[model samples]
Target: MQRVRVSSQQAAVHKLGDSQMTLSPKFRLPAARSTITDHALDFDNSLTGEPLIPGFPDDVALQCLLRVPVDQHTSCKSVCKRWYSLFGSKERFFTLRKVLGFHDPWLFVFAYHKCTGKIEWKVLDLTHLSWHTIPAMPCKDKVCPQGFRCVSIPHEGALFVCGGVVSDVDCPLNLVLKYEARKNRWTVMKKMVTARSFFASGVINGMIYVAGGNSTDLYELDSCEMMDPKNGSWSPVSNMRTHMASYDSAVLDGKFLVTEGWFWPFYVVPRGQIYDPMTDNWENMPAGLREGWTGSSVVIHGNLFVVTEHERTKLKVYDSGNDCWEVVEGPPLPENICKPFRVNCWESRVYVVGRNLHVAVGYVVENYEIATGGNGKKGGRFCVRWETVDAPGSLFDLTPSSAQVLFA
Candidate 1:
């Protein structure tokens, strides 16, 4: 570092004997008379440390910043003003967001660079298309279990991820991994009672519901459990009448709706069942769904809507009062692209995300359109369009190749 000096009285510093350090009359001190007086004794200089730098090449310095995991990256910016400026810049901040959004919208995706054996996590921000990586967890194995699946359920402001099989064959896992958005780190939670994979889990009424898993015998589990995040305990619920293995469940109208799973060893269940936790019972909703009924069910606009992957699947709105399914018309995409669309209710609208190909390379997002027919009616056709990648679209763009729907 270069050293510079100046007189204590001046605010600016200068090198010794530099032209700017000339001592003229302007620098002259006041002359003292020959009279002496009693003086007070005091010598204190406690406040002395490093000075703050006001400016830095933020854009340039930021280039040196490797994307750290989300949990620890914030501290890197907090180290100093220069670092803070570089990391918190609008561009860099947004870039981190995009990374998190694409990695796994639901905060489920974990990445391991086998070469370095570094494990990291990417969390998606649904509102704003962005990415956030979690700090490295203690368990650093590069391999995740072959059939591991992660689910994130929002509690308060944080998201709790639970029940994934560990990579180690000797010690297969039923451990719960939690990612706190405010803290930005992954903390291991209490393990589950049963070890399983490919199950359906979600939060409903301050409790997490986990059900249906593929067991060692290739048979699906009919059992279900409820987890209380507050108490850190689990309890059993009424098991399904039949095995709904590898099924999807959604909470609507104070009831849990499970749909589209293999009823038999190989055939898919065309029936829909509604489970009421309040009543501790399950009621068969109806027999069959429209053909190609792949999308998850959702309750929206004071009604329940069953959307199909294709436009032809149409909109089947259920009237709870009348006990019936009504079809609404609209523009729809190809059925193959999203036979089983992942449906989510955000804000006041219902959104659907589906991949264009079976390989799951590309995806699209669209809003369900509602229309009115004759006599100024309130209902008619419902339609959806593809969401562009550059814009908020079907795929959560984490990096160039990997993508998923935004969830955070």
Candidate 2:
């Protein structure tokens, strides 16, 4: 990749492979043949049209504009329609913006688009209350099965989205999709251990573990498997006893915690159970969640936060060490989130995104606080404010309940 900087004008041209990209006042982008012509457009509408907002070097101004959040950049577009026009066309600004990384304190969300009936993906920057669309992967194989929910696993510098579909009645897709930010592309990875949807998956160390989801026949998986990205193969890890069909799992205290979600009983048996990978055994955590709490659940600060349509004014928090359920104070969701759905936790926050009648809604993303009030004693209160963001594309079952990545 050869990069050339032309000093004749305000902006510099980046030469990569055979493509030449122009920057500054007016961007004279290279043609399809990777050829650059003298013809160019000026940002300033002057006689000669030197440049708009001069004095600052073109390179510096480009960098600053790129620094602004992409979601907020939409507002910048309204400031000057010309500036908005530069977004999709200019190559320099796009290249620089992608590299900056959306490492803001936020939760990325993906919902099943009822209008198109395809999955709609987005990321929410909790701090800024912004939304950006993430492009979906090109499912060339058409083998990518759909599960009920989507999960995102951040690997290397790319986020891997996999699993889930409303109707996996036929050939379910167990394959995973990896999205690269720099390239702005999605590539299909290896398949998961089993063909099931509505299950939970978490990432620990260098492996991805998915547990307990119904198959095409609506048969729930009893065992969990681990995937080594290096080998692109699945290996046996442990089996969960409860056979929870729609439960959530997270890595807590260096071990995985699977909670909430539910199972259909044959003889009226309790459907929920919690499992610890270290011990390879499922233990009944707290008694309150026995009825099967749905929605989304997350494990933060050694406590479990479960939200559902069943309960809105309060959030259920379970103490891992003591194995006790504590009611925490929190605001009710936007009313749409109380229905059955999947929840994801990232950076001490919980996000719930689900669908009803194929229409997606809920707390696209929000921060969570843990109030310590259990056993007639005031424990402690911890809160984290979060803003929503749109991941680049529609993702399925990226990361299970408790498994999440925090950029601090």
Candidate 3:
């Protein structure tokens, strides 16, 4: 039997015994679709009379577009003027995604090339387990990794890369760059009032705060400031009791905690501070809390957890009532996930990015209890389930400096 080739237009034609009918042109597939470049040329056209998707209601079309993978958002925005307007505005697009339950959690890794010391960002789509690169940051000067502080307003789909040092000149920079996930674009925001490096920064009540970092002369800075993301304006905040650069930091219970981690040689105890937004003041961290904060930290469900930086890399949760750290009931950190890692969490899951971009995810359960004996003796325990994912070979040369989770 011979097969007949039907043109797209003819494919829409139907026969009904004695009668023949053709579907509406809107229902027919075009033989050749317009290229993105062609659509881009009409970007300036007004969307006042244009439908988001042809032959469909704007609301239905919006729902369809909301389901599109975030990686393809740029291409979708280039499809038409109305789409560009929707995808380019964070308030409209991200707000809709949040309201409609279409946003997804993504892991953003700030990594640097070990050989060249060049810094870049990579994003992991948690839902699909895929990786993609974001646009290059606006910094023109050479900079070092781990010298800047990154913070985000996850629900707003925004990430901010704050102050850092210029590697070539050994100068601190106040440059602030904002990445809008919805549009997949970067905007250079207002610079911080103080140039700093290796600072402690966190978001509280939609405001970004930075404190206790190195200044231009490599002197530890005790000065602090807060930025209202809405206006991109910075204002002075109360200074820390002492000048200390952050070795690890977290925002828990609506406050920012910064610790100058323990140093080798066992000389002196490290210092830590907690900043309360409501009071706009800083308080000394509890002795037990700071003394045992031995590694990077991430807050989950209002509880503070840490992955130890020492050998074996144990997981621990802070017992605030006792002001001490308790071991989490879970397997040790994956052998493949080595030291020099970065940690971040969302909801009950913890993400640790180790050398070579290897990731280990820990699902945590708090306040669990285990029965010890027939006498009914029970011990309170925190449990974690571990899972690991390997990095692509292309990312093997990159080492993570920071990791953040954003919803988009």
Candidate 4:
């Protein structure tokens, strides 16, 4: 049997025997700086003195530390230099979590205050059912929600907030900011080649891609670019067939799909485009797919699902074989989860955040059934169970613009 001391001041001890190890109830590390930016400039990374936990091998200690809840990491890092080195470095802490297959999905919502118009980010820990506030984005200029696009590389536990318009001036920006979940820090990354807003952005093969958005002069841009996050550099990609701005976009089956969405006047069909990284080219989206795309889209289990924009929001799944969308069997979007909601999914759950930060979780059933519509068209049918999570009263004035899921 081995005994490990977690904290000397607290005199907390955990016994490691043949069975699994559990931390002592009193084992609490000292509190540290809440935000990385507070001490990032003066922080030291040199490891010295003791192992992560005294009286245990470093490797064995790591397994015990890995079990710490992510929310407690800030406090745990303050215990010692060795512990800080383990949790402070993304390549060390986050990469190990991925290797060990300890993924806890957290939803990051980018929202703005309705009265003040100040933008901020809030994270929902799906596992613990709690909320955490991250460091403010490092943008010098005031910006509005929906103008910038947020995308994440889930496995790496990183999120990128790309170009957006200035709140007061409406001028587009090329700025990009990255937030590392494990470090609880934000780092501004290399700017995009072109300043853009309301652009289409997504991750393909671990690379970031942006295309067809409004420029500084408010003209729709036909330009596109790709960035390799490893080096924080951007390269030009083939332009779209026509200058277009995305109303909705999704990465499905490793391909990037962008649709302008149907505009009013009811007769003119919206234009859509598809980007294939392998071909380094763009193609027109199929008429059936683009015309029927009426709302926000999320890809789950390799299938495209959309929450319609109409008065009574309904969930619909795309049928690639039939090239059309069929409404899935599920409860209508919760009355409380009102319009202008942002949607994102992880595994089989579809998360929708509506006005005032209210959330609706929809679980999609895997075994789909074949059903015939009134038009006698065959379509796949799946069932969804809906549940709602209310936002804290303090955030009642906030409205979400975008949401992304990251695993840590």
Candidate 5:
């Protein structure tokens, strides 16, 4: 096992360098939906302050251009220098799209070269169900990463990759790579105060929270850290309740919930905790909910959903109010199929990527209840419906994270 270590300087934000926050004047006022079709902004790109497009008004032209699908954005960018500058600005493009109600959700899967083992990310367009390539992660030797952890910032078109192993030698790194959805590129971000692997991370309210990973040995560290994207700086988060590695994590009710691990044990023991940013403190997780969070999890409709690690046969949800695991009983997996290679959830839908790159999108068919024998009462049950499609290729082994859903 690889381990890394860094000191926890609480209540302190590291000043690595100057912030990379860039602002342009053109994107200042967002175009209102009421005037999306009727009018256009008078912003000028020419030397004499003339509107960008020759025939139509600039805002009207931009409104039409923004309606173009994201896959065709690069083609639009190549028309002229002004077009390139307008489309290339991640903030402007996404902002205009949001104003026009054209926000689309996509699934990002980080897969590796089947033969060479070179790691890269693929974007699955949920609208069209097509596969597309994203920019390669900036890793050492431009090869696959080690001890890597990724968290998606959905509102903004970006994903963050923190601390990964640099090479086969297990030389741990403190690198943070940021991926911009609009730009289709990856750029390095400010370093994490510490370099560690297998850490638990989540983004809440635009701030990135990371906790618990290894440092220098097999032991897990209790230290934590947070990053502010606005300033491109890293700050130390409050330490965890106990020094234990987290197997899976999800946010619930504005709190980051992490669970299922041990503190130097031979047998499996699930230790869980919750970190509330409002208070910047950790608390012990409830009993029943803590035990079964041993697999990949995502937050859907303000509830914690899990895809079991052993078989990925059934979908499970945790009812925090009652503190119990409720299984979504529907169709079982095919006899020939095994556990999924990756899983993610968005809104009411859950997506699973099978070993052969078979994609199954599951959603609740209807709401009903099963008759429980106790006290003449009924229990909650979900009838999940599945839709399957084949993606481009098979996933490589040693993937650190599963697929993530993003709205761009």
Candidate 6:
């Protein structure tokens, strides 16, 4: 692929081959079961002591302070030294955010309207079930010209968009954009190491990873790289074992799973590959995992759930413990949704926004072990429910290219 500058002000694009780091491949795959440590408990149990704010008593102060939303933590921190100490512990702060029911799921949908030849971002406040227009992306003509893949920083309520093709270019895009929900604005970030489209992406342990997509000349790339938000820079990583055009990605048990979206001749594709950032290695996935992951995939409570086919598709859960897939149902849903829709998993809750402006919110209530399922292979069973909400208005007829979830 030909290298191009992102812009005069953007960082120079880097390639995997340009770095001195060895691009070695190890075939070892981690256990299908993830061994990554769970997040630290979000709450501090020792908050019954003396008050940090001086005037208030400990118990009384705790009640009043917990009411403050997570987004306002920065300002609350500036109140005094003690407030910073209390809010500085991210785990405890998030725990409070969750415990007090302050964390609300926010959804972002990227729509490129061919009718007007423009791209606009719409954000839905799921808690209140309403939509708000966000700042326009910088990519001119058709933003995310080919198709955009969105990754979210739920804790910080920020979003990143990558991949997609531009109207004027023969190749896809390496341009990346960041959306800060607090400010409801979009800004260009460091360009990707490689220009590609339809790549696999996800956020694991807060790092953004992109792998396998269409490079120049219709080449399906086997390469991959990652971006560290802390430093606002990109670094090359080892490539995947196979050239995969990742259509769907999910983070389960601390590992990023990528599916080989499609293949020529026979349509059958395997379960795909799983990358363990801890070991910096990629391993082939177990067979049959791909079929279950046909469309959207999300992880809830350390368990994997996927929706294949269309809007009304039955939800399937992968029970890593039993090594079997299970069907789950909780709420009834419309038989079909707009052909182009999105499923986003935030804090285990799934939000589907699409067609154009329609939205559906869902959650998995429970999982059950099935006597038999999955092409005669016995699978587990689960329950899920989804309800649709009418968005404010339909700005265009264009389908949503990508969607993400955050809490703000």
Instruction: Write the number of the candidate with greater TM-score, choosing between 1 and 3.
Output: 3
Residue 176 local lDDT, model 6: 88
Consecutive 10-residue window with the lowest summed lDDT within model 4: 36-45
In the range 93-181, model 3's lDDT, one tens digit per residue, is: 55466545676899999999989999999999898787889888989548988899999998888999999888998788999999988
TM-score of 3: 0.78
What's the TM-score of each model vs. the native? 0.56, 0.63, 0.78, 0.78, 0.74, 0.69
Model 1: weakest 10-residue lDDT segment is 36-45
Candidate No. with top lDDT: 3
CA error at residue 382 for candidate 6, angstroms? 2.2
* Ranked candidates (TM-score, high to low): 3, 4, 5, 6, 2, 1
What is the per-residue lDDT of model 4 for residues 136-209, given as tens digits with 9 covering 90 to 100? 88885478788899999987889999999987898999998899987678998999999999999999999999
True-vs-predicted CA distance for residue 179, candidate 4, Å: 0.8
**lDDT by residue (tens digit), candidate 2, 1-408:** 122444577765643221233233444433433222121222222222223236754444554565566566656766554456545432434444443443534344444443444554555545554556557765532222345334444434446665655342344557677655445567777887677766766667666777787776666777787777676687777678666665555565656656544444324544565666567666664555554344456665555576644555245665545555554443555443324444665545566554331112222122232232233543334333223233333333232221223231
TM-score of 4: 0.78
**What lDDT tens digits, residue by residue, belong to model 5 across residues 158-204?**
78888866556655567898887866678889999987777788888
lDDT of predicted model 3:
0.81
Ranking by lDDT: 3, 4, 5, 6, 2, 1
Residue pairs with backbone atoms closer than 3 Å in model 4 (clashes): none
